[model samples]
Target: MEKRFNKIVTLFAGLGLLVSCVSENKIEETFGVKKLVDNCVEKTILTINGLTDADSLPRNILQGQAEWNKVGIHDWTSGFWPGILWYAYEASGDSTILSNARKFTEPLYGVLDVPVDNHDLGFMLNCSFGNGYRLTKDSAYHDFLLVAADSLATLFNPKVGTILSWPAMGEKMGWPHNTIIDNMINLELLFWASKNGGSHDLYDMAVRHAETCMNTLVRPDYTIYHVAVFDTINGHFIKGVTHQGYSDNSMWTRGQGWGIYGYTMVYRETGNEKFLDLAEKLADKFIERLPEDGIPYWDFDCPSIPNAPKDASAAAVAASAMLELSTFMKSEELTTKYKDAAVSLLTRLSSDDYSSKDKNKAMLMHSTGHYPNGSEIDASIIYADYYYIEALTRLKKINEGRRL
Candidate 1:
């Protein structure tokens, strides 16, 4: 009897060991996330401080060979650096990171006064002041963002029932009333503003904009166009064109990702069933087109498929969106599908092909910013790093029984 008991005990102990190994392997898979985020933060501080010390306005560090190339404050990409700093502070609780965040954030005060011509005010003010308000709860940040929302509302036209994306370039060039799929990402700021005592009209405008895009921009299969032009005078449909896509009818990977993220946010803000439906459709299409590794080429329609340059930024954005999307799902199957896809993308991005450890003065690599313009191609983009860290933070929160 004693011998039999010993054998059973040994078998149970071995099973326990197997369970522990499985748990540890899962941890091992994600262990690089913290180390990667920390390394990226350290390199970002050095690069931003060095640039600001040299009397620079502080913007995106696109690429660094011997020296870094940065955009100006007026450039659309300017707001992401401060956002990166805020994420660093949230992850580390380091006061020095907060100081740098403030320094970089103040430069965006001028953006509120600049005339609204594009769908980037949310990208500008919300990234800097939006995160600032959330972290610090400072009234100044709130006031600035409220005014920025008002500035954005200036471009909304009741006739067109959507906010204008491209400025009135010229009659001969067409596109007097153009709204791109990218504009969907900007509505979060409008929703936040209205809820926080800004304007009800702003909320209405956002809903109308989403409706207009849903009507024209999204195809039946959930593939999206880069740009859609309409008759400004009467809200008549003009034509759809490709500004930064493979063709006029192809899916621009980043743009489709934006659609998913944007519609997910709209559903969150409004509890509208239609917005949720749209988000789920876009999410399904995006998941269908993802490469086996989950990262995507700049455009899904690119002929080079296996050899195409991957855009880590799009994956980062999509993963973040999927994590949020899982919370709104009703079915266990869909929740698992979206959440697992997010984890897979995050895992691949943290690998050597994408993750960097201060190697080239950037965090996430292999991000293609604008394939059509041949600008910032195959480099580390600041926004890519921002969203990657944001997704990691979201996952950490989920593990700890919290929300981001």
Candidate 2:
């Protein structure tokens, strides 16, 4: 049903383009969308090729070490690097980029068949195989995504009303049921799976998990908790806490970005007005608190304030989400506001101060990953680049008279 609906929308979009006589070049000239995308692709190719002569690609560039770090397929972030390569190929039609994307994506096949904990299977599979299927319409890619969606659904707890994020590895910190804001990004895989002929149960699990997140993690002011613990046995809410933020009550910048992205996605899949409202509220809160550069600090409540490290990754994620959210909005005022805010944020990320000087390194800098653990602080993270490219693609689609 969803597929049929999308086909109709596509038909109408094509008719509209024909009627308006809007060529791709005209749209690109008006928005400079293709120019920005071309720049990103050039930077990505240079950075990726420069990272290694070996088969492995860099997960991230460690600025202090002046080297790139690689991770295995099971790693939470393994999918994004290849996913970026696919995007590059899509934009440029470069045969070398396509070959590299295929090579990098081949290693990720293990993720579909293996058992893994953590809620990032969506990130792992969706970015790689998800994009692969979208572009090539390969049956193998579709089958793998189905397998991965089933694998991800195994973590969902009916009692807890959410997918368990972390396993009970540590007695002090790990609970039987723990959900994180990052899990929200994974739900897209579930929704796609169900709509594409997977189980209705997977779709139901996603909706329930989203509702539980909104109830437990989202605060009145639109800030979000990094973690939500539940008593799985009794189906009771235990506590809200922070593992990566400044403190338990403080707002982690990336968590807020996840909220904005996640809820906007829910609105997209479900057409729920309340979810759209929540996404817009979170976007406003995030934009309202931005520093002068339109980027965000590592944590909203960080004591360093003006001295805190900027998280260009969070800004990228939120900007991308806002762009998509704007497409669903009915009010012209809200749409323009969100669109302008996303443009401002992306402009900051593309500026000389935030963008890497050397084309052979990470593109956008100043990302904070696991700050409380003292890992990847103020460095360029892979997922940041992924979302930045995604945002640009979305904007380009919008300008070309298409849906986001």
Candidate 3:
């Protein structure tokens, strides 16, 4: 009887040891991964600060004939930098940052009214005008948004049931037949148009564009192609091709993020079941591929890119999108799963490794702007900064409930 009792005690002790080991492993996986990402964010912020001067303008802007050299030019990319700055300001309530952002955006008002032949009008005007309206509630911002919407509406093609990418350039590419995954961002203008301008046509066009993208651009597995060529004359799918990714069938991480977020936005605007379903499917695929660190590579399918670096920007964007999708999910299991994943990613970004306490760069690390083209790989991109702050903001709101 004594021997038997001793054997049972030993068995219970071993089981408890195993459970403790597993628990420690899980905690390390969560916190350890976040530490690396946080370091990246710190470095990025430091770098951005180094690039700027006392006036809060980038030192590069002081150079002659650079894109940032001009004060009032309609720079499509400027909005992202200021947007991130605004986000940082809002997060910390730092008055100096807010003042600098206003200074940066005030000069660009001239070009916001000018019609440009770019697909990034939403990235440009939406960040500036939308933020302006949200902050000041000024009618001028609303007016600018309307003008942008008008320009964007002209890009819509009824045949393809989507927006024409950009003006046909040197090549024989059909204007109305061209669509890209990035057009997801452009759809926000349509949503604003419908809400502010009372244009049902814009909303209908946005919905159809999303549907066309779903039918033509997205794969059965939820991975996305960068661009799809359609028949301008007859609304027929022509061919799917990759513009910036490794190959036509390759899964670009940022493109997947765009699909995830875009579909979620579509669901929000229209309450469409199909959009929500697609968003969930894409989220599933994304979460499955995350590394132990929670950050993703620039392209999931191209795991063998020689010397290719990880893209922190893509991870940040996907994290923000996942947070948005979490709100719409009915399953608490899924909500907790996605919300935790997003929080993990954001926590990593906010850690000392990813973020700089000195505020030199104003970004978090691991941004790859372009790898195949050998441009801006593993560098700090303005949009990456913006999306990272957006992810942080969303995470804060989620944690604080509706108070934020």
Candidate 4:
């Protein structure tokens, strides 16, 4: 659901948000919160129980495939499956879910046992063990997350002021120092560790990486480049390009979502107004480009319009970011604006067009994963389901006057 080319003004004029044409929107309605979350999660468990275990993690399933395309512990997405389980346990308090989550989580220790090869340790460990520690307060999980943070820190290039997203591939791709916008989300693991027991250098490294991304990756209008190439020689800017987006110039919807979520979280952890400002700007740009449905297409600038694959995964990511962002706004109007936007997104995601419902064992569908590679086109991706459940849980808590 991207704003089609050249129709931006007309679309805004003819159509208003679900909240209204202007002013704050009401958020107290009973939108079947418990039923929706429970059913989606129940379907998730039923669908995944048979496919996933400590041995393999489900990534995505294409149409006509009877089973999900599974991966081993080395897969970057492995932690999301367990992270989803931890969120499920937090929401339902189901002991079975808890047991299954632990079953899937313990095997990931191999990540810390090896030298970090990629910038996804945060995704691999934090999503799984980080949430586990937050929910269960398991001392082992806490200790593991601290090690994960240190491992992730080893990837930081002090010269570039950003973590190397793909260390092994950088040499082959001729990008000596490359940082993807998705790297922003991983900073949370470092932030958490610095406050817990790790050195404050972890926190400093995260902020530096974010600052590098803010300067190099974010475009003038705040639409993000999927990847930014930095000069390794002097740690100077080289050029902005894309590997997963439509082109070197187009706005990747998911990249923008990562920036939004990243900076909001940075602000939350650091109490920095500059980060909050950047988060607000990123959110505004995202909202400006969103189509009527609030979900975004794979790329806002993709030549294809109605035919471009919709990334429900991007919507889930932004929805969760906005919910937390709304809490930090000083202006009542802006806070209402974000929370209302989040509600609109969640409502649409719950609808038949997006929600897998009885059709599949996943929570949501129609996610565009690596469209340029023609991989997992319009499939149910694991990260989509992970962030979708996380957003739903956050909404449920917010509605009940509980802390997110």
| Clash numbers, per candidate | 0, 0, 26, 1
Model 4: lDDT of residue 48? 56
Q: Judged by TM-score relative to the true structure, which candidate is superior, 3 or 4?
A: 4
lDDT against the true structure, each candidate: 0.82, 0.86, 0.71, 0.87
TM-score of each: 0.89, 0.91, 0.80, 0.91
Ranking by lDDT: 4, 2, 1, 3
Q: Candidate 1: lDDT of 268?
A: 92
Q: Model 4: per-residue lDDT, tens digit, 215-251?
A: 9999988889888888888999888889889999999
Comparing candidate 2 with candidate 4, which one achieves the higher TM-score?
4
The candidate scoring highest on lDDT is 4
Native-vs-model 3 lDDT?
0.71
lDDT (Cα) of model 4: 0.87
Better of 2 and 3 by lDDT: 2
Task: Please give, for residues 245-290, the per-residue lDDT of candidate 1 as tens digits.
Answer: 8899999998998999999999898899999999989989988998
Determine the backbone clash count of candidate 2. 0
Clashing residue pairs in candidate 1, if any?
A: none
RMSD of candidate 2 to the truth, in angstroms, is 6.9
Clash pairs (backbone) in predicted model 2: none
